[model samples]
Target chain A: MACMNEDGQWIVLMGLLTALGLFFLALIINQSALVGQTTAEGVLEFPKNDIRDLRSEIFDVYDSYGTLHAQGRLGDVEEDIIRISLERKNAVVHFGNDTPQDVSGRDLHPVTIHYNNGVTEYDEIVYY
Target chain B: MVNDSGQLYTMEGVAAGVIMLLTAYIVISTTSIYTPGDTHIPDMQLEQLGSDVLAMMDTPDREGGTSQLVGFVKNGTETCGGNDLRNEFLTNCKMRAGDEDTKLRAQVYLSYRRTDGTVNTTPLSLPDPEFTGRENAVRVTRWVQLDGILPGIPDIEHSSRPRAVLVEVLLWRA
Candidate 1:
C-alpha cells in the first residue's frame, strides 16, 4: 500500500510539471504572433517615391525654355514665345506669334510632353 | 499501524514538493525571466510605433488648395484623443511654429528606460528641414529589421542583435 501511494504522488507531480511547461510554450507562441503582426504593419507604412523622376523631367523642360531664350536662333522675339501648361492627360504648349516659321514635323521643338499618354500638340495663337 | 502513518507522511511530502515546484515555476515565468524562445517584445513595440509615425507622415493636410504632408509630434497631450494605439501615439506628439517656413517643421520624441526601471521621455524638434523637407517627404522610404533581439531593451548585452527598427519619413509639400 505504501509503495502504491508513493507512485501515485510521483505521477501527479510529473503531470503538473508537464502542464506548466505547455502553458509556457503557449505563451511564447502568443508573443511571437504579436511581434510578427507589428513587424508586418511597420513594413506597410514605408513610403515610395515613384513621382521623383517625373518631377525632374518637368524641371528639365523649364531649363530648356531658359536655354532657348538665351540663344539668338529664335526669330521674331515678340511672337515666337511658348508657354507650357499641364492638362489632365497632356501637356499643352501654346505658341505665340514669335514662334519660328519653319517649325514642323518631329524636328519642331516640343515645349510640352505628355507623360501618361503619348500626345503632343502645339497651338499657335496670333493676337491682333 | 506504523506503515499507515509513514504512507501518510510520504504523501504529504510529495504533495508539498509538487506545490513548491509549481509555485517556483510560476514566479520565475512571471517576473525577471528571459527565455531563449521568447519573442522580441521591444522590436514588436518599435515596429508598431514606426508604423504609426509613417502613417502620420502619409496623411495629407490641405492648405490654400494644395495638399501637403504635415506631421506633428506631441507628448503628454490629447491632440489625437482616440483609443487606437496609433492615435494614442500621435496624441503624444506636439507641433510648434518656428522659422519663416512652417512647412519644414518636425517634432520628435525620444523615450528611454532609466536605471530605476522608469521611462525617461524627451522631446526634440528637428532643425527646419534638417531631417526632412518637401522633397524628402515626397520621396520618403521606410525599412524594418527582423531579428530576435530588439533595440534599446534594458540591460541585455545583445546590442548588435540586428533587432533595431528604423523609421525614415520624408517630408514633401506640393
Candidate 2:
C-alpha cells in the first residue's frame, strides 16, 4: 500500500509540471506576435509633416537676414558686401569695406538670429 | 493491487505530458510563422507631387520669387482631383491671389547662401484642414517666409538678402 501511494504522488507531480510549462510557452508566443504586428503598422505611416518642418526652419533663417539688409542697420552704406555664406549653421557675412583702422580698433561686430528650430548662431567677419 | 495502481498513475502522467508538449508546439510554430500584411504606401507619389510644384514655381507666370508654402492632408474616403486638391491646399496654406488671380499658396523665397554654403532659411507654419477628403489621410500645410536682418552692415546685409529661392510644395492623394 505504501509503495502504491508513493508512485501515484510522483505521477501527479509530473502532470502538474507539464501543464505549467505549456502555459508559459503559449504566453511567450502570443507576446512576440503582438510586437511584430505593431512594428509593421508603424512602418507604413510616413510622417510627412516632420520633413516639412525641417525645410521650413531652414528658410526662416534666410528671411531674418533679408529683413536686416532692408533695414540698413547692418553696416556702412559705402562698404561693399563681399561673400555671404551660412556655415556650421551660422551666417558668415563678409565685407570688403574693412579698413585698417576698423581692424585695429577691434570693431568686429557679431549678430545673432533665432531660427524656428530655436537654433541661435552669430554672424561675424574676419578682416584681412 | 500495488502494481495495477502504479501502471494507472504512470499512464495518466504520460497523457498529461503529451498534452502539454502539443500545446507548446502549436504556440511556438504559430508565433514564428505569422506575419502582418503590408499596407504602407511608398513615397513615390509625394516625391512626384513635390517635383511638380517646384516645376510650377519656375514658370514665368509663377516666377520663382520669395513666398511661403503651406497646406495639409485631410483624412477621409473621398478621392480628390487636381482642382479640389489645389483649392484645399490654398485654403489651408493661407495663399493669396496673384495678379493673374491664381490662388498662390506655395511661395519660393530667394536668399543668399549661409556660412555653410547652403541657402538661408525661412520660417514655415502648416495648418490642418477641417475636412479630410480621404480615409486614413492626414492634412499637412507649410508656411515659409524669408528672414530679415539689421541694417548698415554690408556683410550682414548681403548675407541676409535673398539669394537662393525657397519653393514650398503641397500635395494630396489623387
Best by TM-score: 2
Q: How close to the true structure is residue B42 of candidate 2, measured as C-alpha lDDT?
A: 26
lDDT of 1 at B134: 35
Give one digit per residue, the lDDT tens place, for model 2 in B71-120.
11111112332234445444543333543324233322222344444344
Worst 10 residues of 2 chain A by lDDT: A76-85
TM-score of chain B of each: 0.32, 0.28
lDDT by residue (tens digit), candidate 1, B1-174: 123346576668657866776676566555433333223443333344444455454344643221111122211122321112233333322232443322332333323232233333333333333443334232222222222333222232343322111123323222
What are the per-residue Cα lDDT tens digits for candidate 1 across A66-85? 44346532321211111111
Candidate 1 global CA lDDT score: 0.34
TM-score quality measure for candidate 1: 0.25
* TM-scores, all models, native as reference: 0.25, 0.30
List clash counts for every candidate, in order.
18, 66
True contacts kept of each: 0.00, 0.08
| Per-candidate interface DockQ score | 0.02, 0.08
